[model samples]
Target: MSDQPVHIIANFTVQDAAKYREYEKGFFPILKKHGGEFITFDDSSVTFEGTAPPQGRVVIFKFPTEDAATSWYNDPDYQSLSEHRRAGTTLNFLTMVHSLPPRN
Candidate 1:
């Protein structure tokens, strides 16, 4: 797999705070396990020029590599934890963006 860093952007509206909190409690551990870093999140995101701006909370996180990000998402524990998120929130998208390759 390529060593390029990968960023994940997620948009979702929390419908059940308790359930979402349950997912959050286990998120960092799983993320750290796969070398992922939480960047930032915005509850009130503004749209400048985009036609389809995210409707709810916007979160951004990064991983050292695409493989790491993929592994994090595919991990059994993470998948199990995500059930809470799926039940508690309306997910818009969980997109993966690849960083530019090294300028050799």
Candidate 2:
């Protein structure tokens, strides 16, 4: 966290609605195991905007340290579930960003 925050942006392909929901069941638990938090989700309906549906799913989680982020990404449980996510959808781009430290 570095007294700031780590930001992540992941855009993905979700063709089946039911499968996506099922993936969540596996995902949310793994994330919680790694101390992850659910900040914002696409509300299961991306059509809220003209952007379109199945634009992909987005998630936001915070960690107190970069290592925690690394751990979460590399955890075995997540690794197993990640295979499902990868098989089910296409992840266009996933990024990790850390905010600039605040001025004293």
Strongest candidate by lDDT? 1
lDDT per residue for candidate 1 within 29-74, as digits (tens), equals: 9999999999999999888775766578999999999999999999
**Which parts of model 1 are misplaced by more than 4 Å?**
none
Residues 34-91, candidate 2, lDDT per residue (tens digit)? Answer: 6667678663544454655345677666665566677888998878777767767777
For model 1 the local lDDT of residue 24 reads 94
What is candidate 1's CA lDDT for residue 38?
98
What RMSD value applies to candidate 1?
A: 1.0
Instruction: State, as a TM-score between 0 and 1, how close model 1 is to the true structure.
Output: 0.95
State in Å the error of residue 77, model 2.
0.6
Backbone clash pairs for candidate 2 read 1-64
